[model samples]
Target: MLSLAGWSVLIQASLAAIPSYVMQCAYLPGKILDGVDRVNRNFLWGSSDSAKKVNWVGWDKVTKSKEERGLRLHSAKGRNIALLAKLNWRFQIESEALWVKVLKMKYSIKRGRDIFNKGSRWLVGKDSGLNVWHSNWTNGGSLRKLIHGPITQEASFLEVKDIMLDTGWDWGKIPFEISLEIKRMIQAIPVTILSRGAGKLIWAGSPQGTFDLRSAYRLAMGNNMVFNKKNRNSSLALEIVRQALEYYHCVASPRLQTCKVLKGIRWERLPQGWMKLNTDGSANGNPGLAGCGGVIRNDAGQWVVGFSKCIDITSSFVAELWGLREGLILCCNLYITSLEIELDAKVIVDILNKPAYVNNIISPILDDCRLLASRIPQIRVKHCFRQANRCADSLARMSVSLDSVFSSFHSSPVDLLDVFEDDFNGVNVNKLCPEPDVPL
Candidate 1:
């Protein structure tokens, strides 16, 4: 007896409760999916399955954003894969854990040594754990295979740091005759003698030096591209089935309530006589190809100007700072007096606001941003929700494929027009807020 809107909310609530990791591992049977799809159709039409097909748009369109001409419902399969990819990502990046060790030992025992051996290499930190000869430190194979150095049995287990010097590698101390190839390989190894602790393993073919589900899913989908073409409407069908199953699951948790914090906020215009700037940044991978984008608007919420810049391989954090710096520079050139800058990244705002010195790789970029901000008159930088910064987000994403290092737009891009209109209209965007914790 529930209305379509009521059913939709109920279904979403059910979905929110189920842990995404469970769905990632357990592939639901086809029969279960059929029953779920049947229920979704029922709730969507508010009628039985005997009735004519009520679905107008396909499911593929449903999962896309409003800008993409879709309803913005996430695909169950896509979500599952995305979640599961996180597990694989953690396994590669994180330090050894009980669970990780267990999984590794389990697979290695069943598959044998060749299973884990893929010519992968590790960056030496303190070089305490690495074995000089047995470990795969050299480019092609173990160093022992290349040069069987004459040494006492006790020295056979020598670590990589044993030959390290304060300045650089001490290649002369080794007893074996160093070949040209071995010497080249030794020089190529990025061993930091000052660094403390065990070295970290690097996953080959990962551009960001870390694992990502988006990358994993892209690879998985590529293999199934032929299958996808066969059923171009597969997304459409999957959406229907997903909704039905969600509704059935909702019946088990009627008491659950959806949070309303996100729906309550809307994009607001700047104060009179002040310009508003919204900035965003994106990277293909954490330290991969990145881009910075920003949009400046007048008091009336009309776009004054926008910018997109393709930055070389850099972290997303640096990209965000660059976006703000670029926006400030443009505003200064335009002779804007009072300004308000908004960004979706809270971490960047925190780092800038603090007085402490940043001694890391990003210290120079952070200092540049701070210096630029000081020159701007009556400027205030604040954090806003990503939902409200759609135009800037879109521009940043577009910068990824741009050939030019920098580009500026006097007017809004065609693809961002809808999002711009939505912001101007003060449309309420749905964002799921975390539920309040209740003591049992």
Candidate 2:
């Protein structure tokens, strides 16, 4: 009987044989073993001088010999070991092939240069026929064509890593060098896609997709970069498109389309003997406890008239309409010809400018203001900002606290001339509105 140590050694040898045997069998058609044999023969006995040396037939014979020997050497005690070894060998071979393909593709730009330029004599010059009398013909046209456009350098790994970080990717655990390389690979693909305008088609097809890319680009470039401005505007345009898409899809909020409508006339002054009127409204809560305000400032910075009132209304829209009405009534009462009016509400402005009327709630009031404004000679209505007219906002806020006092004065035109006159003449207030018409 064999000793235990000797038996163990035999078992180990047998186990190692199975995988090598399987690989030899599987790769027979590919002639993998034939290549190995040639290498082995060259190493051991030197290459044969024969032109038609050992080829695929010789490799097939070697593989067959190895497989037969492996099968005969297999034993029940080593079955699991043999199976595992074969599996490992197969996996390793697959992994190596995949890695080789990846490396080749990754460096294709540099490696493919020769293949791309194979037929171009302009790129690869020919040897002269005679050394002394060399006739060198130039292919300048082909060379110029090949070199068209600027040659852009690839982004550095560090630059790519910085871009990835700006996009909110966390790659801190990866080694700096590895992370940078990976980032460069990822960004390079998108940059190429974007430059070709192919990326726009992809983004346009999906809702909000364009906006997301624009935002991503902005984030990558950073706020300080000039591209950020361009990207941010692009993002806004995309957002508008996305909003429209949502509406078309029936996913938009109803309130998004609803805008405040005003009922007041705007007033202003023209250089050629005319007064301009403007009306505006403000509401802290929609359809509830709203405020209406209007201002009538002439071209001379003199306040002809202005009023702000808090009404127990349901929406800001109503308050806005009320402001228009108040301004129109004031203008009509003042009998100011050549009236110009302004408001900050775009919807209200549109309504007044166009003959068509919408929004039943404010239509009647808007009509009333329109009729009154029409009665005046050369009446005009325009939009102005909340900041442009502080007097109006202050009055609106004050109306909330003094609702009872203003409502009581509806029957009579409360004189605000003295109050404004005193305030305008005040030392502290005068500096700011030094020449009230001269905007700061």
TM-score per candidate: 0.42, 0.33
Regions more than 4 Å wrong, model 1 = 1-262, 435-440
Deviation of model 1 at 275, angstroms? 0.9
RMSD of each: 17.4, 31.5
lDDT of candidate 1 at residue 117, scale 0 to 100:
34
The stretch of ten residues in a row with the least summed lDDT in candidate 2 is 193-202
Which regions of candidate 2 deviate over 4 angstroms? 1-269, 403-440
Candidate 2 lDDT over residue span 224-266, tens digit each: 2222112234246667887889887775444444333433222
**Residue range 318-436, candidate 1, lDDT tens digits:** 67877877787788878888888888999877777786845223433455577666777788878888988888999998986776757899998888999999998888788766666
The candidate that achieves the highest lDDT relative to the unseen native structure: 1
